[model samples]
Target chain A: MLAMSASDESARSPGVLIVDDDAGIRENIADLLSTEDYRVYSAADADEALHVLEAEDIDLLVTDFQMPGRNGVELIEAARKANHLVPAILMTAYLYVYEQLDADRRKDITLLRKPFDADEILREIAARLGDGNAPKR
Target chain B: MTIPPAAGPKAPPSAGADSKPPGNRRTLFGATILIWAVTAGLGILFSVFAVAIGLQAATFDVMRWLLALAIEAPLAAGIIALIWYSRNMHSATAAGEAGAQALAHSEAKYRELIASAPDGIFVLDPQAKVIDVNGAGEELFGLSRAEIVGHSFMEFVPPERLESARSYLADRLKGLRATELYEATFAAADLKPLHVQLRSQVVRPSDAEPYVVYIVRDVTAQREALRNLVETERWASMGRLASFVAHEINTPLTNISLLTASISRRVSDPEIQERLKKIAAQGRIAANITGELLKFARPGAISPIETELTDLIRAAVEQTDAFRKPGVELRDETGTRSVVCTVDPMRIQEVFVNLLKNAYEATPRGRVRIRLQDLGSLVAVSISDTGSGIPPEIQSRLFEAFFTTKKKGEGTGLGLAISRNFVASHGGDITLTSEPGKGSTFTVVLPKQAPGVRATE
Candidate 1:
């Protein structure tokens, strides 16, 4: 299942790295992904998320937008600058966060509201990562 | 009838007279006049005899008076009768003046009581003209006595009830002294329609013409309060029904999602399989959301149990570790006494988690302290943060439902409100104290064994 080309790896199944300040949410999301047989990893905040990104092969990021320090948006920008071709899903309780984001950056990302349902998070993740389960747009 | 403690015998003399022999004043006046007449007659007869003897020898004046009266007893008796008549007339005139003074005092007292009674009192003549009204009556009608007295009672009563009221008054005057009960709308002096309960009783003084006395009582506030109670009950019933519906939907929806996922996992067609999986996932999510909504609709169901205070705090902190700021220290300052309380542990932890989360978010670089202590029968727990405290403007409404300072996407305003409800249900109280720049502290106090031991939650 290993790919030799960088683009092939980037285009592979999404590697979701959950960065939330709530352990229950992180655990629930991880548990949800595990039940679906998707490889999932969890971090408490942006710093831990970055550490995981550096050490592991990641294709997608799902991080909360209001965590301490550089939040989900900052993480995505940093990851992109580091030659990481990953699409991210930004989770926040604030709807205005999406409005504030640049239009170009928003195209590659989706926003999830807190207290979110497991199904919505998974569907959004699949759509953003171009999973074969989602209709191609 | 036995008098009340307030009307005991030791009450003032004036108060006693009202309850004692009612006609004693007239008897005492008659006795005083008779005594004054007899004493004046003796002095006048002696003066007349001395004047007759004055023409004789001055030395014989006193002796002559005695001897002359003894010799002409019949003439002396006539002279004595004349003196007695003059003295009796003078005493009678003085008694008349005293009686008049007494009458004036009693009249003044009667006037004072009628003027000062708290109940709205009104007097109506046989023809239904307002005779007299107290200040309370004036206020009830929003008019001065001068304005309402000449006006017929019908002017105040609702039109439909006016004729009936007139008949009632007529009947009261015919010795059928019964109280009439009627709820009618009256026009206030300001022309506002005031709902009132009017009771007309026939007041008949023995010598005076009978008048129909009306007692008007306003019941608007009481009626409005009852209406509000009924409205509140209706909303509560609706909330209960909505919760039941949500619970019903959540159960079956959960089952459907479970079945769908099983079917999708067994499918062989990859494209169809993926779509089915997504559907199952979305279905599960919908079910969870329904469950959350149901939780909000229904009141908490768990019965409180005696639980350790420190244990609850630790559980909440552990549950919310993901939300805590990195590098932020958590410190517990619990006294040696293991503070225990009867409460729904899960719900109490939820409250703690919310407060801790808010505190964690408020602080940037300092420690968050959680302290617990037992103060007699009550246990207190405080969570303090060293971050930027809550602003003063938001503190007043911090626990109000749907009030939140966090940006719209950041927090639901329901957390603190729900937390307050949970704390209150335990027979406990919660308070928040904050300094705009220094930080904030939230304190919760609960009884050792939940609040209502004899009642069910």
Candidate 2:
């Protein structure tokens, strides 16, 4: 009897699933996106995130690189095989290692570093959501 | 007191164009005989003329007068000629003897120089075989003079280094190559390894054949001492790098704490409020790691206080009279801003004073510059002097406790040692670069982030 009318009529409310090992980070992201009126979901790790992706539709995947097992890139690939074309935005503390990823994946996925200002990641999310004309910086 | 020049002694016969030594005796004999015959003939002619004139002449004995003139006149001339020849021969012998004595004294002194030297000295022929060795050489190789002389110099070189040693020597013998110095390992008579510093020279004496002089100093202890010093400096440099890494991480940690706390203030949702608190806690955890790294880089001793680095340097420059004098410029090139750092102000000011005084003393009229700049992650404060630099031999020992080049009563030698301790306590390092006659630069590289800010009023 939890709210199921979320995806029924609101085409404007895009669903996003944030995944990280730190529950606090995932909660903060979900809370921030929820305030923006997007339908936000979160998971503690990749395993749990995959479960959420299979059950419900999510428009975007925001995942952290370092995790206990099955890091962000692997989780994204696994979700893609399940017929989920969830465009991803990767978050990492290490940019150098991230740059060495497959060229196609690097070109498609958006990268975000931690300790960014509140406006920065929000703008990236808005831009990916097809909200036209947000400052890239 | 003017001593009178004595009346001349008997003059020796001049060995000029006329007075040849070989002809002197024969020519004098010829002249005596000729003069005697002419005088005797004249005396007889006079006596006969008197008897012929039929005058009653006084008693005139021609035979007696002729005999007396022949005996006395030629004998006097012969004695003078003999005396002149002997005197010239005596002077020639004395001069030759004196010259020989001086040459012997010089040669003895040279031999003594080699014999008494602390290092091995070898004289080698053009073939690179040893022609001679001094007493030290014999002791160094554990060989007698006979065994070492005439042996190939390469024989004493350690087997591992023989080829390179041979090539180094070969380069020197290729003409006009008189001086070359190198380090090599040599094997003693007992096959023990001996580290040596060798210098070669090709000397050409006018009357003697040319030879190479190989001066070898057994430098095993010196090399070990130098290695220990290098190792110590390397560890110190690594410590400095670690502090820089800690500082770079620290800047981001600050952003994390500030941003997360700011987010917490704007948000009121209960679930998110819990999350924001966790983020702030996690930032503190990250900061703790940086703190541990900083403590590892520099041990905790003195409590550091926040102070503007430029102000400290300026105050130090003003305190020392030498820095205030005319014609000498003490420039604070750290720019116009206050770059804040956590340090012991009094201790740091003392460090600045020491560095400034050193620079001023070294430079009589040129520039003594102090520069503070951010080197990406680290803050560097440097004092440079356009002065006669510390020689390389002394540079390594500049930070050693009680090591000073200043005169007695002018320095206690503890200034640099204490300064290094204070800087090290604050996760910083002091380093020196000196080129003799050019100048010296003393730089202190420090971290911008303290372990945790305790900026006191």
> Which pairs in model 1 have colliding backbones?
A21-B322, A21-B323, A93-B409, A94-B409, B363-B387
Residue-level lDDT of model 2, residues A1-137, one tens digit each, is 01122554454477788887765566556655545556677887889888888876678888887789898888888888887887888876544335457677665478875544445667778877676422222
**Top candidate by DockQ:** 2
Best by lDDT: 2
Model 2 regions more than 4 Å off:
A1-11, A132-137, B1-457
Each prediction's fraction of true contacts recovered? 0.02, 0.02
Error of 2 at A121 (Å): 2.1
List model 1 lDDT by residue over B232-330, tens digit each. Answer: 676467557755666446434534554455455456788988887777666656654454344444444446777887888888878877777787888
> For model 2, what is the alpha-carbon lDDT of residue B99?
52
TM-score of chain A of 1: 0.81
| Per-prediction backbone clash count | 5, 0
Residues B199-261 of candidate 2: C-alpha lDDT, one tens digit per residue: 876665444455667888899889889999997787577557856776567546645664675
Error of 1 at B86 (Å): 14
In order, the first chain's TM-score in every candidate is 0.81, 0.84
